[model samples]
Structure formats: structure tokens, C-alpha cells
Target: MKMNICMVGALLLLGVAASGCANNRDLIAKSVIPARNDVFTEGGNGAQAGRAVVDFTLLVKSNLYYLMGTYGKHTAPPYRAHLNIDGQTTILEADPILEDNNSVGLKAPESGTGWKYQFSKRLTLAPGKHRLSIALPIDDVIVEREIEIRPGINTVAVTPVYKRKMLRPYKGENFSAGVKTVEIAVN
Candidate 1:
């Protein structure tokens, strides 16, 4: 009777709600390298008491569109880094790491030689909680995270969110991108 119809309708509504939640599960589409358990392997020894040092490793994936045209593509792009501690924000300078033999992107290695490139910076921070934000313009994404510093050398590796589409057509410019929480660990 009427009770049976009401129960069926309620179950249908619940099913729809669960499917919507599934779509929102993946906020940022990217694979984390080194994994979470292995991030502390490269941080070296811990820092001294009352003082914490942070080492940053920037990883930028090569854009595949560069191979389509004859124009030279730049592998290193300038990035803006902001570190906020105790309500104070500090802007850090970014420098590019030169690859071996001046190689650009990841390609076939010549004989036994290999090359890699990235930007790195070290910051001395007081023992406590701090927030770090990195703005990467290549894909118009900003990564933000909160980290705890406790008498040790902390290493953070940053990279853009992975996307399946390699090439995106140029569109009209009046738009804003979404913000997602990027995980950064303090070793």
C-alpha cells in the first residue's frame, strides 16, 4: 500500500545521494611520488631543539605540447612560495636546478647518462605549526598545506596535480581555478 511506496522512494533517494558523494571523492587528481611512508627517507638527521629546518623539492612534469611544435619549450617555470608562521607571511625566492648536459625534459638517456631538474630552498623555522603555499602557474593551481616543525629537518616535495589531458586549448581568460589541500609532511 502507501507504506511500501514510501519505503521504495526513500531508498531511491539514498542511492542518488551516495553516488553524488562518490563524484566528490577525488578532490585533486594527482599521484604522490615516493608515497607517504617513504617521504622522510631523504630528510637526513633531525634538527636541533627549538630550531627546525625545512628543505623543499619542486617537481615539475614536462608538458607534452612542446613536442608538437618547433618552438623551444621551457622546462623551468618561475613559482611563488609563501610561508606563513604565527600569522606572518614570508615570500621565499625560487631558483631552478640545472640538469646534467643541459637536458630539458625526460627523454631517452644517452648511453649511461641521466638527468633531472627541480627547484629547492631551505628555510629555518621556529618549532611550531606553519603553513606553506606554492603557486604553480603552469596549470594554474595553488597548493597549500599546514605542517608541524619539531626540532628536525623537514623535507617537502611539491608537484602539480596530475591530469589526463596533456594539451588544453587556449580559452578566454576570465576565470578562476579551484583550490585543493595538498599534503606536505614535516620529517
Candidate 2:
């Protein structure tokens, strides 16, 4: 009789514990983009810019890290990557790309578009990996996906784009639209 009572108590406690885990995934209150968070799609939540930027921002709860993306013509004279990590801002330029920081990326890496480049930056995360957030202050464009980190070694990519000037005479007069693709993933 006593054994039966104890077994029932254990099962009850197990049920509650399982439910707690499910709730945690929903804790991130917000994400980087206003639309659904899908990196594989174009013009969804995040927008990849050219040398001419349409800036944006993103917001999150706590703990978790987020990434932004950019791509463009790499072999040209104007290429820049500007990032803001927790308020501390850093800008990467091409002169340093070849001089000190081996920060190398393929020029126009994407197929068909000889003007898209992709790259990332990883962040050192804290314990209790909270909600993931990536802000795009450039035109309110945020690029990120959901993730759960255990403790150490957490990373994110911050991609800002610089584009060659649109020499096309009709660019300003008409609607000019182009797509530059960059990707972020983990094992």
C-alpha cells in the first residue's frame, strides 16, 4: 500500500518537470524581426543591403544571442562591416581584411548575383541562455533564428553590407530591387 502511494507521487512530480521545459522555449518574448523568423527566405523579416544601406534594429529579452547578415561585391574599393555588440560598436574595413584580420569572404559568393557577400561574428554568451535577440537598426531589419545554448562557447554573426554605387541612370527613378544572400548555422 505504501509503495503504491510513493510511486504515484513520483509520477506526479515527473509530469510537472516535463511541462516546465516546454514553457522555456516560449520564454523569449520577442525576436529580431517583426515577421516570422526564417533565414532561408528573402525580404521576409531581414533584408540584405548593398553599399547603400537601409539600416534597422532588433530587440530580445536576455541571455540568448542573435546575428545579422550582409552580402555584396567583394573585389571592389568600398566594402565595410559595421556591428554593434551589446552597445560596444566595431567596424571592419577592407584594408584590415587583407592587412591584419584574415577576415576574408568570397566576393559575390552567391550564384547569379555577383554582388552578394555573406559573413558572421560569434558572441561569448553567459549561462542560462535566455531569449535570442538580433536587432537591425537599419530600417528595423532583424535577422536571427531560435536557439538553445547549454553554457559555454556561444556565437553569433553580425553582417553589415556596403555596396558599389548604382551607376544605372534609372535606379533612382524606377524601383530597383536586388537580393544578396548570407547564411548562419550550427552543428
Candidate 3:
């Protein structure tokens, strides 16, 4: 009798898990179709109206590592990015521009290891609320925000920040725990 009850309970749990997965699949299917359609359709006739300019900048570290005894200067890798606003998607690619001493939150070691690359874009958008999505495929970073674009110039900055544990001084185990999150700030 106990064996039978255990089997029945297992079957019931399996059924519930299957049903939950089905419901999630249905929800994703329904939502994806509309988003796909929105990408193709024109936004509206608001092109002649007042517009706002968005200056977007993304700062990320290159995959290349500069060692203490490195001989020559190495160039950063190229990156591909996607900027989507209210269903309008623009694909961007750029060779990484090398920069130095642009660290945030904490100061770097005396070896002068604070180096990064910058990618920038200027977008003209209609004055209204917008859904902004930024994706860096190579870096596996995606950030989404609901932003209000007023008439004038606005700035959006995307940066990769280090994890809290990684910021601590000279911890052996946490040394490899790099970026914690990608932060997006608008002003």
C-alpha cells in the first residue's frame, strides 16, 4: 500500500510539472509573435514631429589580457551590438577603441590595469516613452529599460561593473570573479 501511494504521488508531481511547462510555452509563443510583428511595422507618422537625440555609450573590457611582462601593445577585439527601441532594432559593429584609467567604483592596482574600450552611437527618437534594449552578443550582456525621451539631447551609458567580492583586497579565491552585472544609466 505504501509503494502504491508513493507511485501515485510521483505521477501527480510529474503531471503538475508538465502542465506548468505547457503553460509557460503557450505564454512565450503568444508574446513572441507580437514582438516579431512589431519589428517590421513602421512606428508611426511622428517623423515630422519634435524628436529627441540619445547619445549611447557602451564601455566594456576586451578579452585580451595585458600581462606585466608583455612586449607589444595588443588591440582589442571587435564587438557586435544590438540597440532596440520600441521594436526598432539596429545592428552595430565596431572595432574597440582603447582607453585607459576609466575604472569605476574602485581604483586599480599600481600596475595600471584599468583599461577598457568604448563604443558609442547617436540615435534620434520621437519624443515619448520608449523601451530600450541593448545587447552585446559577444559579451553575453543584455539590458532593458523603460525610458522617457524628452525633446533635447539625452545620454545613456552602459558599463560592466565588478562583483562586490571581486572588489575586496587581494583575495585569492575571488580574483577570477570578474564582472557582476551590466549597468545602464540614463540622464
Best by lDDT: 3
- Give all candidate RMSDs, comma-separated: 13.6, 21.7, 9.8
Candidate 2 TM-score, true structure as reference: 0.27
lDDT of 1 by residue, 4-74 (tens): 99999999999998775444223212211112231222223456566677787654433212224332233
Score every model by TM-score. Answer: 0.45, 0.27, 0.55
Q: Which residue pairs come into collision in candidate 1?
A: 47-152
lDDT tens readout by residue for model 3, 1-187? 9999999999999999777534333322332232432422222333334776777787665433546744222334345556777766765555544444434323442123333456677777777788777765443456668888777777888876543343565532221233434678888
User: 65-166 in candidate 2: lDDT tens per residue?
Assistant: 122533233333343343432223333332212111123333321112122223343433333323334432322333444544444343444333322225
Q: Report the number of clashing residue pairs per model.
A: 1, 22, 0
lDDT, residue 60, candidate 3: 60
For all candidates in order, the CA lDDT equals: 0.44, 0.32, 0.55
Order the numbered candidates by lDDT, best leading.
3, 1, 2
